[model samples]
Target chain A: MIILIDDNPIDTFIQTKALELGGYRGRIEAFRSAEKALDYFQGISTSAIEADSFILLDIRIPSMNGFEFLDALQRLDKEVVSTFPVYFLSSSLDLEDRQRANTYPNVVGFLEKPLTRHVVAGLPGIRKAAS
Target chain B: MQISIFARKSDFQEVTHIKGLLKEWSPKVFQYGETARVGKLTREIVILYKPQLTEELIRIAAEVRILSPSCYLLVIGEGIPGMTLFHAQVNCALQLSEIGRIPELIHELKARAERITSDGGSMAMQELQEKNKELEKINFELDRFVYSASHDLRSPLTSVLGLLYLLREEVKAEGAQRYVSLMEESILKLDNIIRDIVAYSRNNRAGLQIEEIQLPELISDVEPGLRYLETGEITVSGCVKVKAAFPFSSDRNRLVTILNNLISNSIKYRHPARLPEIELNLERNGQHIVLVVSDNGIGIKEYHLEKIFDMFYRTSDHSTGSGLGLYIVRETIKKLGGTVRVESAVNQGTKFTITLPLAYA
Candidate 1:
């Protein structure tokens, strides 16, 4: 499942279309805000399920941004964090944003904006544990 | 991580004392497993505690059926144990707030010693926290430098563009119209440059110019004075209060600059055909004061939120912005020992909460 979290409805549409075009037939859940995604996570995971799944989160939002969302997710059960791979997706090519994102261990990668076919292909990766 | 280093003979009494101690710590760092140590018999010499001090602890220890694999329990106060080897473990579940990369635990030692404190581990943790805080301060300075420098330039740039506005009108005909547009384009470019300068400047300011400022009056007066693409209703949404540290005469012009820029930003990014809605709300509590400048406009995209204060960074093709408004806002706020935080949604709107010390007038 590919979950797209952003405040832009148009970008969400554009990205979803791009994902489909890229041959992603899986369910693509579009979240208008991070809070909605958080609420969704709160329910699906019980006290027992420790790990969470992957998320493509935007850094800008009304209540909580992408970094805040990552922090909140890390606070969830260890199982949740282990299961979830949170990608920091933003249109901002700001160096500070990338630097700040790197400070957090939970952040997977910082992807630039305009969800083109090439960028979408570069999104998901099975990170092999480094020796 | 929260540390409760108190020693105890048994489980029940330690549990009670630990619970009381945890009120000061956040609930996130709760310990899952707990164990207490039994003292060494090799060098043994016994010390007795009087009825009031040690007897109560002994009673609790007897109930838990305790003795540790490690011969001693920070077990100094003398308590008897039963057949079951299950000892009273001093439970220390740390409840540190989950902010980011946290310090790691260095060692787990036998708790039965006279001093039950976890010194080596805790001290290392403290050092780590201090280092993290210092790093945080540096990033904050960077952000501030970017904002202040950009903000500082806005005034002079405004003056320049203000002159251009006068010149554009003085010139005549379509031929002059082209020059007017050229001047306007230059002003826009200057604006972008100002924004970048502000963002770049934020990291450059040393922690030298710090002062308390009267912010409520500043906000009230500043928003009314600037030019925006959309001139809409700007009002104090709720009761507003002063937020600066020192009292000074109302500098209407500078205040006007701040407010004008803020509100202009609101109007600058408003949705097409929608009236700009701006609010200046103030709240003071305890030692902190908050001034929130909010607007219902086109709003900022999620990705661009952090870089909004960055120099020369623009999110859309709309070209009317100099981009230094918030950067300067941040710098000025930092100089006054204050900070700015932003919240926005793409289509909803944007809100900026600028906080300053409320220790003085």
Candidate 2:
């Protein structure tokens, strides 16, 4: 499963298309804000998340930012939190932002914006065998 | 100079003796009992220490210190040591026999007043320093604003570029394909200009962040970003050669900016008759690192070579760039305490030789 959290609708739409074009055949979930995503994560059961599920979070967002959301996620059951890894997909080229993102143990990678076919193909657990 | 004296009525004879010595200063005498009514002290105040009024003297001295922090306080007499006198905010004190030092003390005070007045007063210096601090704060705020503003600006441009690529892929008609490609080119040009603007501001505002830089990694990182610059039948490529006798450490961001601009410019002005190529050579040259970026492209004329690094100075009428690329490169080089020299010939090529300090202190 692929989870995308971005405030821009155009970016979300492009990401969804990029994923589809890159041959990602799985459940794709997207949220327009970090708050909404956190709410959904809180409501879901531990069993609902598969081993392949991961999050693509944006750093800049309204109300609750990516870092604040990560702080909130720490309060969830450790088992559920440990089940999936997170990656940052942002437009920021700031070195400080990349270093800060690395401090989060769950963040596996940092990708620049306008997610392309090349970037999607590099993601883990999104590709499945032909039906 | 004006001196204010606070003393007991019984010490009138001693006060008169002290008054005779300090005749140079018009001393204003006040009763010790009227300490509470001492209103708005501006100049020097002398307190005649009496053993019984020790507590009162300490309290009044502290009050004066707090009310007028710049006011000088002098306590003259026995019973209280100099260390204890300082705790009560007393500037200095002297015994009855040491009364001869009064003029010397007054002379020192007069000199201090003159120094303050000559330097436009300590108050003025404080105000000037405060204004400088405020300006530094504003400059910091403005740098942050530009950083975030550029990020905000680039986000939408990338979105459009992505959509344009998607559109180009799905469009089947040749005419529509051509139109999509044209729009893509226009958008990419706009994106380049925006990127240049960000680089210019960043070079002007951001401080140098030194890091260990592998020559091959830096060159490879820059090449992929400019992949789109190659189109049609023209093939633009870069060849890098490194002769590193030792480790090289410098500002990574600034190095990236310099390389990106130079390589992009080489591609932008590629020779139409041949496959354009960018050649980068990095070598250690005695306490410094020298990088040479040479290219076989449409080289600048002699008249235009000197003006190329000037801000917003375009080399030719056909140039479509923001004209800030070379300017930013020059500025970034200057900031790193590096020097850049250009040598070129019309229709043949251009070469830029840059020398930077190995370790920037």
Considering every candidate listed, which one attains the maximal lDDT? 2
Interface RMSD of 1: 17.1
Candidate 2: tens digits of C-alpha lDDT, residues B167-263: 8768889999898888877877887887787778778878888988887767655654565564554433333344343458888778888998888
Q: On a 0 to 1 DockQ scale, where is model 1? A: 0.01
Give the range of the ten consecutive residues with the poorest summed lDDT in model 2 chain A: A122-131
Error of 2 at A70 (Å): 3.4
Question: What are the per-model C-alpha RMSD values against the true structure?
Answer: 24.8, 14.5
Q: Provide TM-scores for the models.
A: 0.32, 0.66
List fnat per candidate, in order.
0.00, 0.38
lDDT of 1 at B125: 43
